[model samples]
Target: MKILQIINSLDTGGAEKLILETIPLFNKRNVQTDLAVLNGFDYPFLKILKKLNCCSIFSLGNKSVYNPFLIFKIRPLLKNYDIVHVHIFPSLYWVALAKMLSFSKVKLVYTEHSTSNNRRKRFIFKILDKFIYSFYSKIITISPEVDTNIKAHLKYNNDKFVLVQNGINLDTIKNEKPISKKELLPNLENDSYILTQVSSFRYPKDQKTVIKSLKKLNDNVVLVLIGDGPLRNECEVLVEELNLSKRVFFLGIRMDVINILKASDIIILSSHHEGLSLSSVEGMASEKPFIASDAPGLGDIVRNAGILFPINDDSSLAKEISKLLENSEHYQETVTKCLKRANDYSIDKTITKEINLYKSLLEK
Candidate 1:
């Protein structure tokens, strides 16, 4: 099964990272995998993909990919690969056009990675996603929340939406030395309670919420920020303004997130929305409890193991963080439950599901 995976850019977002992590876990078995990027830019993940020796391709994109010129290029490319898998924003829109225009007999699969609450957007997205999205042979969503949206949008073939709970490959971290815990998380004594977070430093993420929450906490606590984006400067200012400069460390665009999570005392997720937080999964797998912003998909992730505070509610977030800090037994219990829950979203489970879907589509 020759497969082509198309994404926007090889940035360090959860959806992009999941695709990078997934390529290695999949059994190639004469099934060659090709990766294509539309909005191409050189990113750190390219080196990682090369390290795995995976098939990687990038396009300057045809007049921004929404034009008819796209079909001339992408359609022919689709005919070369037996299966075409598309991810997130532009990929979903462009892949639908490519599949329909090609008239090529190949499987088209889309994995939805986010949730939307804007009711105004609901109609537009529903129409566009439902009409143009019909080219897909199968629809895969990382979170069940997306399934609900898919059902509402596409009245026909609603059953195509399958949930694949984003999974973590723990073996990648366990055997390796994990980038020397000190190097990734330096100058920290055992007495310090380290709180780690890994998310693209973007607006919806609101790392400021985490920073504001931490501002009210005691001096013994340290906050580690990972991933980089437009909001990094804004977050730095917030940390400085809150006088958390000494306590907060912004480790931008980290390649060793799992190592940082493994070394930290607990993980915290402040994302305003998530399909399935792979970061949260990594934290749970590392046997740590998490505090997350209460949002649709995120609420589902923190249901049993972590505490959920209202989105953008810094006061509530601070109160919950303080609660976890004060009660050792509560933290321990949450960690145990989180670890157990993380097992349910294992790479073994997700890989099996994804492969089966690929094979099923091939048979058709």
Candidate 2:
């Protein structure tokens, strides 16, 4: 079967990472999977995927991802594939429009990656979303929270929605060699503990809470923020305003995230909500006490396996970190549980389910 995975520019995000990791496995299974990007910008993920050369890559245009012109650009490409799977916003809308405009019968599948978005907040957008979502043959939700939220927002009840939780390659993270503390934090003391949060600085992510919680922790604990976005500058200003410039490090986008996660003393994902964050799974698989906000998409995965702090509650987050630091046995036990939990969302299982879904769509 031929599958075309479409998205906006593959910058830094969970959906981008999912495409990067899964295309190769799909090809290995003898499925011809190709990728098409609406905005063919030279982002880090795009550069890395180009290097792998695992599948054919198509760039519709270098214009804005939301440009209405993308609909025309993508419409022609739809005829070449049996299934066109889309990810993220504008791309989702554009691909759906392309399918409608071209009258293409190719099955369209969209993966809803988050529990909430700005589009759902407005009445006009609710109308627009309902019309846009109707074009897809199947809609995949990366988490149960995502599934529930989108269903309620669209006010539709049908078998069109499928729950396929997001996953990561656990073994790759577990086996990755850690970057030494001295190299990761050159100025910090050798004995210092590092609290790392690997997420793009975005609206749904609560990096501010993580940064604020750093102030309540011991001086030896430092914060490392990875991945960059529009809110990154705001976060940097917060760190400075909080007089935490010395303790917080903004590492931007790094290709070697697994190594950094393995090296860190603790892994955290302070988000307002999530659709089963891959970083949460990666953190747990790192064998560190994975701490996250007790929000919808995140709480479901982290409650029994790792630590959950109140959403946007920095004080509670600091207390949780303190508890883990104060007791070695508890810390070790949490790590063991987290690593065991990570096993449930393996990429292998996700791939098998996805391939089966593709087959079923064709059979129908």
Candidate 3:
């Protein structure tokens, strides 16, 4: 079946990376797949998509589904593609709009990568995740929590949502040697304990919590905040307020996350909520234990692999950090558990399951 994956921008993020990884899987199965990037196509992941024979269509789809010209633009393309799969929310807006305008019968699939509790995103684009989602051919979520969370949005008997947990490519990260901490930052050496987090500084993926948690750390651990977003300056300001300038390292948008994960001693995630964080998954794959918030999606994955603290509790987070640092036995135990659990998120498993899902959906 010819498939068209719709996305807002082919930028770097969990959703972007996940979509990029899926294109090859479709190609391997001889499925003709193309992409609909709602904006610019210059992202590194999008560049790779072009190489994979995925056609890029610049969509006028924006934050709202009211992009009147989008349907006119996308309607013509739907004549050939059999399916239109949307990744993320705003893109879903366009897919839903385009499906309404399509002259041909194209299967509409929407994947919910994050929970709808996103305050900032919701303020402007309140996700119409109501029963209208039932209009789609199939619904997919990245974690069980997301599937469970849908109950609050839809009435009973909305249909069973497919739970496709985020997958990790062990082969991609395993054998590669880690970039030494000194080489990447060119400052700290063996004396530094690099505690890193990969996240776009957004309200839900609470980078401020991590910055706050850093201030309470008993040790002189280096805090590395990777990835960029609106909250970058806010996090920096918090670091300054706490006088953590020397300790906090704000390295925005590093593509080589696995290499950094490998080099770091510990990873930290203080997201107020999540839908299966790709960064934490990569950290587990890299055998680095993390200190993540006890929120949905993330809490389930980091259960045994890392220490969990209350979402908004700085004291509890500080206590957990101290526990990990002081207790060598527990630290090693968490690491061992994390490494073993990482295998559960293997790329082969994710790819195989997704292909099966696609085939099943197509057959119906």
Global lDDT of model 1: 0.77
166-283 per-residue lDDT for model 2 (tens digits) = 7898778877999988898889897689999999888898899999998899899999999988999999999999999999999999999989998898999999888889999999
Instruction: List CA RMSD, all candidates.
Output: 2.6, 1.0, 2.9
Give residue 164's error in model 3 in angstroms: 1.9
Q: Write the per-residue lDDT of candidate 1 for residues 306-325, one digit (tens) a residue.
A: 78888888889778777777
Top TM-score prediction, candidate number? 2
Q: Which ten residues in a row have the lowest lDDT in candidate 3?
A: 118-127
The residue-level lDDT of candidate 2 at 168 comes to 92
- Against the reference, the lDDT scores of all candidates come to 0.77, 0.92, 0.75
Candidate 2: segments with Cα more than 4 A from true spot: none
* Candidate 1, superposed: residue stretches over 4 Å from native: 28-30, 56-71, 117-125, 176-191
Taking the tens digit of each residue's C-alpha lDDT, what string does model 3 give over 1-364?
7778877787778888887887777677687677777675477777777777655455454444445566566677767777777877656665666667664677777788876555324523324555347557777878888877765555446464777787877788788678878887786756667788888877787877777877777456778888888878988898899998988888887767788888887878888788878878888777767788999888888896778889888888778877877788888888888888878888777767766777888888
- Report the C-alpha displacement of residue 152, candidate 2, in angstroms: 1.4
Clashing pairs in 3: 227-253
